[model samples]
Target: MDCEKQTTEYKSLLKIRTGDKGFKDLSVTCVALANAQGGRIFIGYDDKKKAPLPEQHVTPDEVNEAVTKLRSLCFNVGLVASEICTDDTGSQYFIVSVSPSMHSVATTSDGRIYIRVADKCEPVRSEDLQRLGEEKGAYQWELVRTKYLLDGVALDALRQLANDIRKSSRVRQHVKQMDDVELAENYHLVDEGYLTNLGVLWLGTAKQRSSICYPATVQYIVYDVLERKVRKEEWHDNRLNPKELLLDIEQKAVELTYSYEFPNGLFRKQIRHYHPKLVRELLVNALAHKSYTISSDIMIKVFSDRLEISNPGGLPLGITKDNILHAKHRRNPNMIELLSALEMMEGEGSGYDLIYELNAMEAKNPPMIESSYNEVTVIQNAEIIDTELLPLLDFVLQNYQLTQKAFTAFGIIAREKKVFSTRLSAILQLQEEDRLRSYTDKLLKDNIIGRNGAKKGTQFFVNPQLIKNAKVNLKTTLKTVEPYVLRTLIMEDLRAHPKSKISEIGGRLPEIDLQELRKMIYSMVDVELITEGARTDRRYALK
Candidate 1:
């Protein structure tokens, strides 16, 4: 059984068959799981011990009895599928599968609502209903019509938007033919003589936004190497709508951003320390998906070597850092539609995809995305790791059409020079080998990439001929250089950790294979650069 999460829960018993409690305890959990995201419940399992209790086999009737009374005990949830199964050691456990409630909320027979949060089932508080309902598709905060009429919105902003959309190449030509009124309605910005919450965001004035407590603010601060602030600019003027705010931020970022140039052929190739498209898309995503209910400004911090952008509302419900690239969950549908029409995204629900694609194009490290309960922060390192990759990726773009994910995979291989198959899936945040292959197989087949070894020891690298064609200046072979570089990194890591296991080293460098990493450590041991611990507690340390 998987560990308890937002979707899975484990229990020691199927039912509390004593007195008047009936199956209330198990039923409450079922309702809670169904209310949030459909999840599984495993009974007769000892979660702490990580084992199944054999005594559970003696109570087969209890499992069937609980399933019989499930519907009457849980409300607004579908009929749960359950089963009694035998484990390898002949231990029996009951399992109940609950689907997410079709309704916004799932309740118990007593009419109290509950929701699954992380690993625990908590009673739903009144304020949490909106958040849960929106996630469940029952409500959209962006569509709620405001008390203000269309006339109440800032007319100046509306005119600017009309002219902007009229000239926008991204929006459909026929759709752009509509006048301001029709365009506003089509974009879900207005209702019958009234402005929707989204309308208030884009067309309203500072006063209107203040009334709703809608925060349309951004803080751009520059920091020195020592983390001391050198410059700061803030925009809290709600009079500036989403578009104007985006443009303002983009303008300032462009002025302050650092760009590097590389010598190529007879000319020079210039790359921004941070790509403009990346900054624009990151801001757009932060604005589009940010929780408008929370009155907080998006903060952008420009460090000496990287950029950090954090927005309120970590991620939309059901979206996590591990699955952000693959999962699509829009917190603000109206805002999303407007941004998509504005051509900020590569396609619908592909902002993160575009970020990954852009990051790869520069052959930089994969941008870091993390979320807490209250905030989502994206960190983009500004340093360009590989300069020769610029013209080569252009070659691929001209010769082939790869998906955003494929481009990202190609960039990883291009930068790393050589990567083992065992490390690819974890680095890509993809759990399946075939899924990883989907993004990389075409590169191999087209001879854009080279593969060596097989299975666990299988290695992938960018085709050397491709580099030669791109006119890359090679001092040493690309494939031969990475191991020596990785050895230096390993020694640095062990020097800091002193006595560290292979897992500890791998945790710091997830791109390296454990077996290959072990061999590298042993190689260092042979050179008296490292010391190894005993067999039972095998660890590596600096000599």
Candidate 2:
């Protein structure tokens, strides 16, 4: 197969003959692949020729040897299955598939650890390996029994949970029919006659929760426009389960909220400072995805103008912010499954999509996401750009089926008043104009949005008919300034102070070194995204 990048998260390697030197210590590659995603090994096949060996005949010895060697060599890596397949000419190859390690890292016989990166297997050492192990660790911790047993579960809380599940329409009839222990066991809250880590967090007494297997915290901090902390609340008590925490946090946000009210048809519409649904969805996700191993709080920092909901861990193994809008990977599947049973999910791992959809409908700024090795934070700006378009948005939501990206693109044009196609593409983080068709084609086809001019001059806007129907009278507002600089910082600086030199930008972001900043400036300029002034005195601005 073509091997520039892995075709899937999996890969396949070839071994022509068992006696070949390549066969002696093959478990290194096997273990590495298991530690990462997982791959298959094809015996009696040649990696160089991409075909079965010409001279190699049917060999039961090779299959047995390969199996025995792999069993003896790799630990914590499962040889999931094996099969022998034949080509058109009846040439046989033995396939040995290694499954990804669930809760730990796999290592070679000699204690050497390696991880797959693309088509190659590379050694991972020290902190990188530690991070790898932690990536796989949530599965183990979620089901592990804490110091508590089923009897330790608070009776009131257990009764409360049973009632909640029974009340939830999302839960199945059979699931709702289960007794208390059966319900807890079915949800993985109770295991092997004991309260699991999740069970303790969900049903344990306040005192039991405050003293669980892990020292965890949940904080809701309020801030003014200046970013100074005004008020704070902590929820390590865990008296409330995940669902209860979601409601309490959402309610508090509503209590502190300011709102914009207007007429829509016969009824008055009210848009709060924070969307309560979005708040619950974001918080529910934070509760589900947070790394329990990381001894940090799931923090909701509410600013006068925005909200930053931060959880302890970065994204899971294969998730990044760019793909987070569509890619779904759950660090804690048990939490997700249980939450789904209670109808606490926004959609099937589509919370980000819902966040985007809700923001778009409200004409609010698209949620800004920040992720790093230690934390993942979602920043939702509270300002509404267009109040008049709410009626139009309501019409669209009621009428059309838009993908997450389509709604976001529509929102951008509607909020910005007018947006150039290329610039819109960039803001959407799309690298190819062709891919953008999927988001805008329907809008263009339905005449929901009109495209004018061509190429760089092309502008997209909401349909005149719809705007007229709603009597939107949209104001011609400047584009919302993104505070992104370089990869994520500096855009605000350039927008606020056009044609700024490195020194000027440096003054604003003192944390980044001047030389490194200079290099980055030139690199961005090389892509023709930024323009530079005189060589003797370089000043830069967005191109």
Q: Candidate 1: lDDT of 122?
A: 87
Model 2 pairs whose backbones collide: 484-489, 485-488, 485-489, 485-490
Query: Each model's number of backbone clashes?
Result: 0, 4
How would you encode candidate 2's per-residue C-alpha lDDT over 358-394 as one tens digit per residue? 8888988877877655688988888887676777787
Candidate 2, lDDT over the whole model: 0.72
Best by TM-score: 1
lDDT per residue (tens digit) for residues 211-232 in model 1: 8746667898988899999888
Error of 1 at 130 (Å): 2.2
